[model samples]
Structure formats: C-alpha cells, structure tokens
Target: MGTGWLPWSAASLASGAVLLVLAALTLPPTSEVGQVVGTVRREDAAWLMASAAFFLASVALTMGLPAILTLIPAKQQVVGLVGVWIWSIGTIGTSALAAFLILFRATVRVIDISPTDVEQLGQDPVMTLSLLFVFGAFYLGELVVALVLLLASRLPRWIPALLLVHIAAAPVNHLLPEQLQGVQAVVLGGGLMALAVRSTEAWAALRAPATR
Candidate 1:
C-alpha cells in the first residue's frame, strides 16, 4: 500500500482496538435468567446496547485487518489466505450475534416477556447448536490468525504473542470474578494497537531513505 493509505489503515485498526475494549467493559455480567432480565431491564439496557454498538463498530473496522496484516507476511502466503477466510467466517458469526443482541434488547423493552420464557428460549436446541458453532468458529479463527501473524508476519514477536495470550485468556476471563471479566479484551486491544503503531513506524522508516 501507498504511504497515503498506510496512516488510514493504522488509524482504523487502532480505533477498532479501542472500541473492542470499550465493548467488553460495557458488557453485562452473566447471572440467573431472572436476574439477568431484571438487570437488563433496570440498569443494564443502556450499557448492553452501547456494548453491542461498540462491538458492531469494532467488527466493521477490523474486517480488513486479516487482509492488511497478511499482505507482507514473510512466507506461507497460502496459510495467510486460509486464516483470512476463517477470520471472515468468524466475523460474520460475531456480527450476527451482535445484531441479535440489539434485537433482543428491543424486544425486551417493547414486550413484557417472562423470565421463564426467556430461559426456555435460551434452552432451545437450535440456539444451543448455533452458540456452539459461533464460539468454536470465533475462537478457532482467532487462534489461526494469531498463528499466521506469529509465523509469517515480520512484526516483533511480542505482538502476536500478546494476541495468543489474549485468545487463551478470553474464555477463562469469563470464569473470573465479574470485575476481571474484560481484561482479555483489553489485552487484545493493546496488541492490535501495538501492531498498528509498529506498522506505521516500519512504513515511515522505509519511506525516509527515498524521501531524503
């Protein structure tokens, strides 16, 4: 890519990273169905809605990340391509879930849905199957992308290491106390931002000799 577009790409990545962290921060704590409904109704609607919005925006901005990051990989171009495809599928799954969350909140606000009904809906076999697919695809895709970056990209090793750590910790974070739930998102965000900064610096260094 040209120098002109480099800055824009980096900025988009950094912004998306920040939004990811913010989305995680705004997410509600998981609890009993009745408590979850009460939480969503009373104090969590705005937060949950805001979280969904941030997640959507983050996903939109980061959609190109796999392509951009893999552009200059040192080797295994085909592997990078495979990683991109997987990442794209995962992104689509995540986007669907986020959209569903918005609709879910809207439904709760407009209708007097019972907690038992909500609980039953959660137990639907179809929904359970879909959740399994979504979570599996998302985590697997992330791991593949991180591995591509680590094995092929020329960036510092620490960047991809951070991402690997983030991916490993994400599920475990959910098991932690509520206060610690978003830590993995923050770590992932930091890694993305670091990658952006390093890329910009490398591009600038390459241009410096030519400009001189």
Candidate 2:
C-alpha cells in the first residue's frame, strides 16, 4: 500500500515544483502591466500550457495522500482525509482556471488583441469571480491541510511546521524580494518527497516479518 502511494506522492511533488518554477519564470513582469497585450504575448503559451498540465497532475496525485494516511496507525485519519478533500477541491478549481487562462491567452495571441481589450477582459465580472475562486480555494485548502498535518502526527514534526510557516507567510510573501517567492514551492515539494519516502519505509517495516 505504501509502496503504491510513494510514486504518486513523489510525482505530485515533482509536478508542483515544476509548476512553481514555470510560474516564477513565465509570469509577466510587474512593470509590464500597462502593456497588458504585450505582456500576454511575451509569456510563452507553451509554459502556460505546461503549468496547467502540471497543476492537474498535482491534483491527481493529491488524491493518493489520503489513502496513504489511512494505512498509518493514527486516530486523526478523518481530519487528514477532510483536509485532503478540501485540498482536492481547491486544486481542481485552480487547475480548471489554469486551463481556461491558457486557452484565453492563446485566443488573444491568435487574434492579436489590443491592451484595451485585455483590460476589458480583466474587468469582466465573471473573470474576476473566477480569479477570486481560484485563489481562495487554493489558499484555503492549503491552510486546512497544513493544520491537519500538524495535528495528525502522521508526518514528521518538521514537515508540518514548515508547511504552517509557508501558509502563514502568504500575506507577506509578496513583500519579500522577488527571488524568494519561489522558495515556498521548493520547500513544499521537498517536504512532499520526504513524506513519500517516509511512508514507503513505514509500509515496508509493517510488512516485514519479525526478526525473532
């Protein structure tokens, strides 16, 4: 059981790391806001498409975490499962948003739309609402998962602590230097990888015959 989940968790973490790197690299520069159309064009549609793909992959991988948790001898499995479900919802919402944004960008590039049109699109109520939902779901899910992990004791002490710090720092993350923003994703991916390895080991030990 643990062996089966390890691959999924590792893949999820890897995909998340790639998505973070792509976001940091491909995001439009702050100075380019006035030139929205140019900024949109400046972004590589391939990168956006890749990000969407990774986002979906990460979401799929997350589903396996709860199953892995169920194997652990812990009383708080329900809490952890709830967190996983919440995170899944957020990841799915964000994945859809990522896909939609990619398609929208491709359409804009194909039509060679002007900055004014881009601005108008941004102002559209539906777009604004979608953006809100995406961000809201993503963050809320992250927070819940972090809290559950912290309490569940299934993961290492440091893993949940790091995740909590990452979540708590969200509001001020932008205040830090631009280069530091991507560090969170790296830390998260590493933590997930570690969790996967640990889970695999635990499962192996449980399955092993007693030496005596």
Candidate 3:
C-alpha cells in the first residue's frame, strides 16, 4: 500500500502518546494489593475510569506505530523487521492490559469485594498475567523499537535516544513522588511528536521531486 497514511498515522500516534501521558497522570498508585483495592474503593470512579479509557484510546490510536517505523528507510532491513515483530507483541500485551483495566473499572462498581476478595485478587490468574505483561512484554517491545531506530533507521540520533530515556523512565515513574509521576509520559509523548514531525517532513521531501 502507498504511504498516504504516513502523516495521518504519525499524528494519531502522537495523540495517543499524549493520551497515555494523561492516563499515567490519573492512574492511582499501587504499593500493595490492599492499597490497590483501597484505591479502587476510595478514588473517584471517574478518575479511575478516565485512566483506563485514556489508556485504551492511546493504545488503539498508536497501534500502527510498529508499521510506521518499519516503513522508514533503514540500514538493516532485517533488523527493522525484527523490531516490528517484537513491538507488535508488546502492542498485543499492552492492549490486553488496557482491556483488563477497562473491564475491571466497569465491573468494580457493581461487584462487592470484601477483604477476602482482595486476598484472592493477587492470586487470580487473569490479574497476575496482566501484571506480568507490564514487566516483560510491554516495555521490552518499546526497548527493541528504540534499539532498532538507533541501529537501523536514518532518522536523527535524538529520536531513539529520547525513546530510550522514555522507556527507562516509565517503569520507575510510579516510584517517583506523586508530583512527578507523569514525567515519563511527557518524554514519550514528546518523542512521538518529534517522530510525527519528522515523518511529515520526510513525506514532503519524497514528494517534492515528483511534483516538479
């Protein structure tokens, strides 16, 4: 297919990154299972729901990122293909996680959970698996994408560097003080926006000679 969607996809990806940042800002912190349950109970439902909704929207909007990056001219085509496949896994995992969060929020209001429920929540296979995705697939995919960009793509050096920084900061974001939890999201969003601008310029450059 032609790259007519390149600019549009890039724009959507940037918008999704911004929304992901908002989701991170609004999501309640969790130190313990009990605390998480408490947050679900005590935090404003709207806020909790918004976090999930934004996350879902973000993932949905940016699902084409792997494709976009793969289309960029690269020194190593095989490496770019590998990166795309790896990031695709991460996309799937993140999408599942987002869906889980949305379902959790949707059901929480109707279901009554006692202390017993909280204890079981940790052991529940669905929840455990979802949490596992955070540690492994979700971040790993982005890490590989950054590496692919750094090693393969002809884009400016800063693009991959910023992505690396964002990936490094994301997992640790919750450990930061409440005031600074959104920093990773901002970095990621900025990087994605930069990528979008670069893509737009590259598209124009490619079409410039054709227009002559």
Candidate 2 residue runs with Cα over 4 Å from true position: 1-32, 49-53, 67-73, 210-212
Cand. 3 TM to true fold: 0.81
lDDT digits (tens) for residues 1-212 of candidate 2: 23556555545545554555455445544433357566566766654755565566556545545434643445766666666667666666756766776776778768967767767887899988987876676667666666766666767788767666766776777776766766665666555555556655665675577543
Model 2 worst lDDT run, 10 consecutive residues: 24-33
As for model 3, its CA RMSD to the true structure in angstroms is 2.8
- For model 3, how does the per-residue alpha-carbon lDDT over 1-212 read when each residue is reduced to its tens digit? 67677777777777777666767667776655666556766786645655565656446544657445634565666666666566656655665666766666656667876656777877989778766765466567667767877775477888889889987776677688777777887787777777767767777887788899
For candidate 1, write residues 1-212 as lDDT tens digits: 45666767777777777776777777676646666667677765665765576666547545536434533465666776676566656656766677767777778888988889789989999998997787676667667767877776476788889889987886577678888877888888888788678767766877899999
How many clashes in candidate 3? 0
Higher lDDT: candidate 1 or 3? Answer: 1
lDDT value, residue 27 of candidate 2: 56
Q: Each model's C-alpha lDDT?
A: 0.70, 0.62, 0.67
In Å, residue 61's CA in model 3 sits off its true spot by 4.5
TM-score of each: 0.83, 0.75, 0.81
- By lDDT, rank the candidates, best first: 1, 3, 2
Model 2, residue 86: C-alpha shift (Å): 0.6
Candidate 1 deviant stretches above 4 angstroms: 1-4, 48-52, 64-72
